[model samples]
Every structure is written in C-alpha cells, then in structure tokens.
Target: MVNPLDHPLFARVSHYINLINFLVLVPTGFLIHFPYTGAPINLVRNLHFIFMYSFLINGFVRFYWSLFSKHKDLVSGFLWNKHDLKTFWPQIKYYLFIGKQPNNPNKYNPLQKTAYLSFPVLALLQAATGFILYKPEKFGGVVSALGGMSAVRGMHYLIMIIFLAIISVHVYLVFTEATEMFWLMFFGKTEHKKGI
Candidate 1:
C-alpha cells in the first residue's frame, strides 16, 4: 500500500513556507524590540516591518491552504474537537515515553491538531498588537482599548517568546522522530511508521 503522504503538495509545502517566514520574522522582530546599537535602529525597524509584512502575507497563504487546498483529506484537520482534547493525555504520555503513540490516527494526533491550530491565533494576536504598538497615535483607540501601550507591548513580547519556546520543542520533537518525518516535511513522503 502507498503512503498517504506521498503527494508533493501535501503538508510539506505550507510548512516549509511557514518555517521560513517565522525564521526570518522572529529574529528581526526580537532585534527591533530589544535592539542592539550595532546597526542603526531605523534599519532594524525597517527590517522588522518588512518581515512583519511577509509574515502576514504568509499567514494569508496558510489560511487559504487550510480552507481550500485540493488535498481535502484533512483540510481542517488541525481544528480541534472534543475527542482531541480528551485523548490528549495519552499523546502527552507517548511523547514523554510513558505510553504508546495514538492508534494511528488519519494524519495528526489529537495533541498535534490542537497545537498546530494555535499558531494562527497567536499570529493574529501578534499582528494586532504589533500594529497598535507600531503607531500608538494612529491606533490610539486600539492602544487605549488594550489598556495602553504597555499592555500592547507586553502581549507582543509575550507571544514572541512563547512561540520561540514552542518552536524549540517542536524542532526537538521532529528530529527525535524517524528520518522519514524530516523527509515528510521536505518531500512529502513519510515511509509510514508501521502502526503510526
């Protein structure tokens, strides 16, 4: 039997774009927020904005793919449901090496589905606060609504750090899995883990 992940245009392409976007945006954003004097502040700020725009555009593409991709196998696959949350603990145990993997769900495990769905929500929070913080005067209403600039800045920084932490764990998990996992993301072919 063929692996369901054999298709080139499946999960890999969108993930590649997302990883690249985050790789560029996250560093530039961090530098801009806590700038080093090595480069002109204006230059860093410009770079941050450039990457920020790219991040938003990339988000749009991801959203489009989630909703309309031709591979309809699990287009909304990441959206969480009750069963996902209920079965989340076993997956956690599996990850921690105390239990077995879920009984080979269609694509993502329950935990995977919940975790994957959250990034876009985080992106929206980051972008909204980023816009208000970018120009407090222009978005004065937003600034006040968010309980002033300090709160907006706080939330923006918080999300950045949280994503960084999540990405760290994500990378570790990906590499710890079989080599096929890496190729799955790059070439869209995962030699199925028997009973995965």
Candidate 2:
C-alpha cells in the first residue's frame, strides 16, 4: 500500500529548503545583532543577505508551484474556516489534558492550522524589518514610514522573541503530542493513522 505520509515531491523539497533557511538564519541573525565575543559583523551581514535571498527564492518557488500543482489540498489545509475555529477550543483542551482527542480527521488540526497561518505573516515581518535595519538608506522609505529606525528595531526584536517562543512551543508539541507526526515528516511514509 502506498504510504499515506508520502507527500508530494514539492512539499518535501519545500520542507528541506525551509529547514536550511532556518539553520542559515539563526546563526546569521545572532552574529548580526550581537557583536560580542569578537564576531565579525561584516561577515555575518553577508551571510544573512545570502540566506535571505535563498529563503525568498525558495518561498517564491513554493508559491508558484502550489499555484500550479495538483497537490493543492496541502496548501488549502492552511486556510482557516468556521470548523477550525469551532474545534480550536477542543484541541486546546485535549492538549492541556482536559479533554480527549478530537473526532475529526482534518488535514490539519485546528491548532496546527492556526500556527501555520501565523508563520508567513511573522516571516514577512521579520524580513521587512531586517531589510529596513540593514539598509536604512535604501529602505528609508519603509523606516521613515514606520516612524524611524528605532521603531523598526523595536518591532524586529519583538517579532524575534515571538518567533522564538512559537518555535519552542512547536518543538515541544512535536515531541510530546506529535512525535509520530514528526517522524513522518522525516523518514516515515505511512498515512497518518487515526485514533492515535
């Protein structure tokens, strides 16, 4: 039998590229902001720009592929609906140990959809603020439009903290509630078994 977890090739490629993007950004971001311990700001800035372009290209490619590809269901899964909202409370209760697993066999659990939905918006904010701070002259329009460099910096920092928190929770949930799902993301190729 074909593995239900066997995702489309584009999805797999997108996932791998996304992982690479994260790896590249994390260190680059650290070095760019924190010049402590003799870190070279110039080198970090270069690496950050390189990775940022890679990320942008990957994202654009994925967007184009999704628009034209047959596996549109995967993309549609991220969209929120009334049912997702209705199930949100139950999903929370289940995660918090106050209720049982939800009965629906959704493409994405309500909570999962909610989290995934925030990623694109947060990523855009991170990139937009980074660009404004990186070249205040070129992005002076954006910086001035946002009130100034300091405001952009503050927003960037706030978004970074929020991103980190979301990542932490995502990691925890992957190991705790979705260990099997996590495995499927990497090696497993079986359809998601119900009633787990």
Which predicted model would earn the best lDDT? Answer: 2
TM-score of each: 0.82, 0.83
Relative to the true structure, how large is the alpha-carbon lDDT of every model?
A: 0.73, 0.76
Q: How does candidate 1 score on lDDT?
A: 0.73
RMSD of each: 4.3, 4.3
> What are the clashing pairs of model 2?
4-191, 5-190
Candidate 1: tens digits of C-alpha lDDT, residues 1-196: 3364433464566677678877777777777778766857787777677777777777777677667767543354666666677678988999889998777454667766666677878988998888888778899887888888889889998998888887887888777865666756665556545444
lDDT of 2 by residue, 153-172 (tens): 88988887886777788889
Which regions of candidate 2 fall more than 4 Å away from where they truly are? 1-6, 188-196
Which number leads on TM-score?
2
TM-score of 1: 0.82
